[model samples]
Target: MSVDPKTRPPRASAVRKAVQVAPTAVGAFYATSMETFRCMFKRPFHAREFVQQAWFIAGVSIMPALLMAIPFCMMFVYQINILLAEIGAVDLSGAGAGVAIIREIGPVVTVLVVAGAGSTAICADLGSRTIREEIDAMKVLGIDPIQRLVVPRVLASTLIGMFLNGLVSAVGLVGGYIATVYMQGASPGQYVTAISILTKLPDFLVSEVKAAVFGLLAGLVACHLGLNAKGGPKGVGDAVNQTVVFSFLLLFLANSVITTLALH
Candidate 1:
């Protein structure tokens, strides 16, 4: 029955343990996502939770979306106007603005705000609950957390994401117009006239699609990290941070892929 400490194997390092656990973590996340999706059609939909989450996400995200979209879109339009003026095509400034704002800037800004504000909020809320053992209590009471919690949050995020995208696109266009016409001396009438030249119905639709996908992914990331959090409060905080980072990475990758495929 005697055991020698010297003959025992050394414990695995943190780095080694993390590496070993990486694949399982990813698999768990995937399973969570599938289960969340499947539970979407389950009876007793959490309408109130969805509404509350949507309101929360919108409250956190809307102002940031407005404030961030203006400067970014305006500067981009200003630069485009300068180039177009140099080439004697200043009238086409609206086309450039429209293309940039709708096809990229609007969705991109929505991505940042949703991931930074909305998704982080979701993660923090759920993570706090997890740390408080509320999630486990729900499970003990035979409540399906995914149906009652994750589904509503995900749907709310997706709805808010699409709404924010539209709001950002409109604000971005106004900002771009101001930059082009007032700042760059572009003909206001011509600028307005050419907005629909390069951007049409399909571009608009694709942009909305991108926003929906980004929101869905961000929500999934937030919920997964929150539910799996450990180490008490520190774990919850870490999960929130990871939610933002992972949401951004996934959103950008989705954007690139969606844009490429849409264009082709």
Candidate 2:
């Protein structure tokens, strides 16, 4: 009644692999994150460099998304206005649409855009370097890869995320305004007043923080996958793809948690 090895349960082997890999991956992620954070503080804080990188990652890369976002924001406001008009509650349309865009949708959408652009770039850059053995070469030169490579990226991304969120929020609001006021013939002063009354400092601050966290998550995930990639060119592509997917998942998860805790 002895079972053949081939027919034996696969659960044990699967569990073993999971047990071995999961902790190692988790440990590596944390270790790299900590190293990146430490390096961020120790390095010379160049405001010019930070601003330049921030402009590229957050500002320049945001144009395409912003262009696309404008019409969507307008459509959303138009729909909300129509619904409110039908309900004889047209006055609430401005506040309702404004709050929805600024507090939640704007930051979330901006980060998604940033993840698609900036995060992908980060992943590809690091993955290429990793495949070329540049990371290893840095180690040979006694330079810490995390310090030299990961820190600036993480910091730049965090700042960029915040900046982009603000930019998107502003742009979306203007789009909403144009749709609600100019297109719908809503009172300009009323629209402005509604937004002013509905939007609070706390909402904006929370959204900004969420964007920053999202940036850090995106950068760190991309760096982790890229640095750990294997199999050369194919590996680089795989890592870039995984980085985008994982970053997007983590960003949404983090957003849910933050919104639940901070906003609620």
Candidate 3:
């Protein structure tokens, strides 16, 4: 005998709802993020929240940024020095390092650090607040969570992404200097000289723009996932995992598109 329509499980309906709602959710997230950015330009600036988030994103990301910078710097500089040595172009290794570090590696590594560390923290914090009903309380109190919480995180992450790009580039170049000058016995003067000769304004600006876009992507994903989290305690954990995966996926895609367009 067939079950009554009212008595039947809602599994199929739930699946349909999920499929339909997913796109709407994405669109809503994007719209809300843009609105948040716009709101930040208005009065009643949340200086306390903005400064706190900036500190959290930048301060907590520093160690990981350095860790990533050091290893990649050494590896890439070593490889470039070896190749330059083979061609007796060792003096230009600094220029090669500068180009690679500033144009690609610096922004990519810095954004990864922010996503893996800063985004995780934001997801967890917001997810916890969501599950604990603090977000609902905010709504009850007539508070706009997007204006108060979201804009700061997104703006802070973007600005921090830009800052970290510069920081990582500096560290990477320093490592390149040591590798080329100390490890390979290339002259310090030539290593420093070539960087100025090879890199210019456009490379620096492109890197900064890439980092800012990456940051905005990280913040948007983290905030969206965190706010929409469900299923209680386990859901928060899952949302954090999804945040990392989604952030990295979008970041790489954005990086590829930006690099292609900017370079062309």
* Highest lDDT model number: 1
Residue 171 error, candidate 1, Å? 0.3
For candidate 1, lDDT tens digit of each residue in 1-264? 966857655564556778998899889999999999999989899999999999999999999999999999999999998898789888899999999999999999999999999999899989999989999999999999999999999999999999999999999999998998788777888988999999998999999999999999999999999998899999999999999888998999999999999989
In candidate 1 the C-alpha lDDT for residue 71 amounts to 95
- Residues 93-138 of candidate 3 have per-residue lDDT tens digits of 8899999999999999977898999999998988999999998999
Considering TM-score, where higher is better, how would the candidates rank from best to worst? 1, 3, 2
On lDDT, the stronger of 1 and 3 is 1
Model 2 clashing residue pairs (backbone) = none
Output the better candidate (1/2) by TM-score: 1
Off by over 4 Å in 3: 1-25
lDDT per residue (tens digit) for residues 1-264 in model 2: 988978878997798887989888888988888878777878565556556566768655678668866887899889989998998877777788778887787777866777888888888888899989999999999988887777777888898888878888888888988998889988877777788678788889989989889999988998888799889889989888888788888899999999899856
Better of 1 and 3 by TM-score: 1
Q: How close is candidate 1 to the true structure, as a TM-score?
A: 0.93
Model 3 sits at a Cα RMSD from the real structure of 4.3
Alpha-carbon shift of residue 55 in model 3 (angstroms):
1.0
